[model samples]
Target: MQLQVLNSPFSQEQAELLNRILPTLTDQQKLWLSGYLAASQFSGAQAAAPAASQNAGQAVSKDVTIIYGSQSGNSKGLANKAAKTLEGNGYLVTLSSMSDYKPNNLKKVQNLLIVVSTHGEGDPPDNAMTFHEFLHSKRAPKLEGLQFSVLALGDSSYEFFCQTGKQFDDRLEELGGTRLYPRFDCDVDFDEPAAEWLEGVLSSLKDAQGAGAAEAAAAASTLQTIESEYSRTNPFKAEVLDNINLNGRGSNKETHHLELSLEGSGLTFEPGDSLGVYPENDPALVEQLLNELKWSKEDQVTVKQGDVRTLQEALQSYYEITTLTKPLLEKIAPLSTNEGLKELVAQGNGEKLKEYINGRDILDLVRDFGPWGDSAQEFVSILRKIPVRLYSIASSLAANPDEVHLTIGAVRYEANGRERKGVASTYVAERLEPGDHVSVFVQQNENFKLPKNPETPIIMVGPGTGVAPFRSFIQEREETGAEGKSWLFFGDQHFVTDFLYQTEMQKWLKNGALTKLDVAFSRDTEEKVYVQHRMLEQSKELYKWLEEGAVVYICGDEKHMAHDVHNTFIKIIAKEGGLSREKAEEYLAEMQQQKRYQRDVY
Candidate 1:
């Protein structure tokens, strides 16, 4: 407020009166006033213009709206950053989550920017569903005067790369909205592309709407900018403090509980944020690939920045050889003459190509497709860098200052008669010892968070390692001594060997930190009973809690457990509330809009 008053060319009486009036305006009214100030200020800089701001109290400014559809919060962060940038440029900005936005009011928007992420397959993120549907519906208003752009964040490994983003861009254009900038699609490494896209948006908007740099900068600079010295691209190297297997011996699974020291690094994390770990590939796997290709281990190779390293070093620290994507296949196809490989990539067999890419490794691709190949350098050039893996943090900073913890399930399986290991999971499980350094950075997920109302009840459903964030949540709640009632439903294969954090959880339950607890050990029973079944058995009380306004959180496998649990909730609502399936679904959606239902499924 002080900056707004000081920056404007106003007399003492005028500024004093303005200050009293500004604080009472609603978000929409504030936006209208912001536009007015921007236009009035720019008009003052024009030599031919009179003292318009003095004559007319409110003039129009450049208008922009940033709406985000986020599942894990990457889109939301990017949206915030873009909003800050645009505001710095003197635009009247209104930022909102898609779930909270009013679709009917979109027609009033002059400059629209969407930063969204795709969830599973081709589906929109949970918060984006209704907004996505409304835009495609027959009732959507024509957007002839609107100028828009979209930034899509998605994983390239997925078949439907940026499906939600693509849909929004196409729909807006179909409604007669002019393209402010071309729709920008980004893969896992999105920082660079997103920055470039924001620049393009600002350039286009300023040119079309007449916002000068001087005035734009003054306005946008007033907004707070989020900054961190260490980030995804520039991670902090922290030493490991402890690494222990959570499961007992003879268990079929290997789950590691890792504790890392953040003593000297100023990194911090909240309960729901994720930790991104940059891991090196298994040396054994790299050696096997080198042996299979008959390439020289000592051969010099270059990575991204023309930085030179041995072929062995490059494979270990940089290139991804464990998994293969369709893009990699496309690059390798022309180099091979094998009819079988060629047929998979032939003009019309896209599905067959997808079938081949699934569950196949880079070693398998190289072995089956070639005889006479290029140098090691040529092969390495086509591969992509190994991206960092995100793990739900398991410790709260308030509970254990200067320390961060993670619960990782090491993945090991037999594929094509060879043992394959998960990169970061196994690296921490088998390789890292106490005092060893590991590169990591925190990725904040604002979408999945504890309710601000401490007295509000929360129900957590997490099976396997999905229970990670809940551990942090419990710790945070206990640290604050919050009055909220908390319930946890946990499951694994066996009760004896696989009940992770059992002692601590039991202690919490005894101390009244936990209101209720339920467990499911699938292998112990003759017939399988999962978490969803356990939830169904207690339908009456669950519905009672729902009626009492308790929030429900689900985390685990997206393909099965998440879906099954979701359907189970719909059934419970239908039976317990005596409503039809359709009404139950609608009820669930309404709860979602109210933020009573949230999930962190992978």
Candidate 2:
């Protein structure tokens, strides 16, 4: 008898049973199921069964659901890759951003894969908050029959790497869902590890499929479409059109208006998207390091799988020139036995290490270490990679399809009479001259987009350069002729010197494009008022707007401003709206679940 499995036609009750059973599956059982599912896809005539029996009973090949929770685009890329891989193997794949997925649809999942990245301090990515909360809530249904797996990505330097993935694994188990395989927690350099994990997952799932199911998969494989093009590792080189200091010369802080031409690249992005700028090391810093160490500039070095012409070339072309890590300190610590260095690496002194390394560079470390013999390869290997710097796109594709613009704050600070330049920021602001070409890529932000309903009012709270995307939003709204009322709350140090896009904002207000403008110049007043303070002062009106279904958007410093603004909204709901603390909290949470309260805070 030949049994064919095209896609498991799951009944609502069958899905609920699988969800209930998923968390109870043992490790060996998970491995068994994974292998069975994988083999079933290619089992061909060998594992054939009666067609009616196969449809009614056990079946391995099912529609694969790929859901991703991405803060920046890393998880999305991984999810996209996973979908393509399964599609290649003849599996029907449904891919959706977690924020867009209906939370109740988990009850309909027979085979589910979640790819999520943790944000600051173990928080789920902005888009995953709803799904994360729902899974742990009392309202979540028991899932005893579901088979699932999670691949979590995070930065190991953070205490809570892959935290959301862990949460999903635990919660799914608690709800009685079976794990298809052990969850994989990946760190900063996740590509190799992620690929290995993916291979394991696919190999296991391919083994348990019956012959007829296998033939069906083979048929679907030929119909799959996979993307082949430049990605983060290989970005398109874009020529810089202009790089002007937006901040005045006399002002303490330096910021720039960077315009890069993306003509003929076929790259497209929305307003809230970020541009990832790949930067090269500073030549001056490299020369200074060579001089400080008394190392020959002609010394050859190899790193990660490639060789460089010289030590200077290696430093400039590869390796991080700024931001010293604990590993670097550890390498130098033994040589120095300096009390400070020893104390930094000592037991129960994590905070001390953080304080010591916050702003210091490699030069400072070498100066204190008294110079020693370390190969260029060892030095660069121990050092972190030069990560791409992300800047919010300040221009809309609707306005400029052939170019992208950025408002970048040049990071310059003084310490020990030496100037420190932020590796990537300085590279973009000072080193990359106008007309120079630099590699670039787009990072989409689906959570931060304007509401689908154009008439939905938007209240934007972005101080300093956080106001960058709001400009794009206003432009987009103007171009689309949206009837939504736009209100902006922007703050900086001074009105005279710190107000960005002053003329444009004034024009927007004058032309009725912007319904309200609230400016908070923290330094102008002795009392020091910020955007949150302004929000609090206008609690009555703010509450009214919230009541009238205005979508609240906050983007800026996450440490203080975002938190403060969030708390202010909660207070306004409590005090101005006459709700209790818990009720006000519920109201805010409801708004987030409803997607009315959104943030793009960095």
- Report the lDDT of model 2 for residue 124: 94
Worst 10 residues of 1 by lDDT: 47-56
- What ranges in model 2 sit over 4 Å off? 1-58, 100-110, 137-147, 170-182, 210-228, 292-295, 304-309, 326-352, 365-374, 414-418
How well does candidate 1 score on lDDT at residue 41? 80
On residues 1-602, what C-alpha lDDT tens digit does candidate 2 reach at each position?
22223345776667667767777889899998888677656643443553235655776655788899988778998898888777656567899987788878878787789999998889999889878888899999988878788999987556566889999989999998888767999876676667666765665565545334444445434322343344565688999999977675566667788899989878888877888888887888888888886667887777556555677877786667666666567775665546767777888987777676777777777776555445655555566666677788888888777999988887788875688887888887778898799999887777778888999999999998889888888888877888999999999888777788888899989887789999999988989999989888888999989888999888888878998888889899999878998999999988986878878776
TM-score of 2: 0.82
Top lDDT prediction, candidate number: 1
Q: Tell me the deviation in Å of residue 551 in model 1.
A: 0.8
lDDT of each: 0.86, 0.79
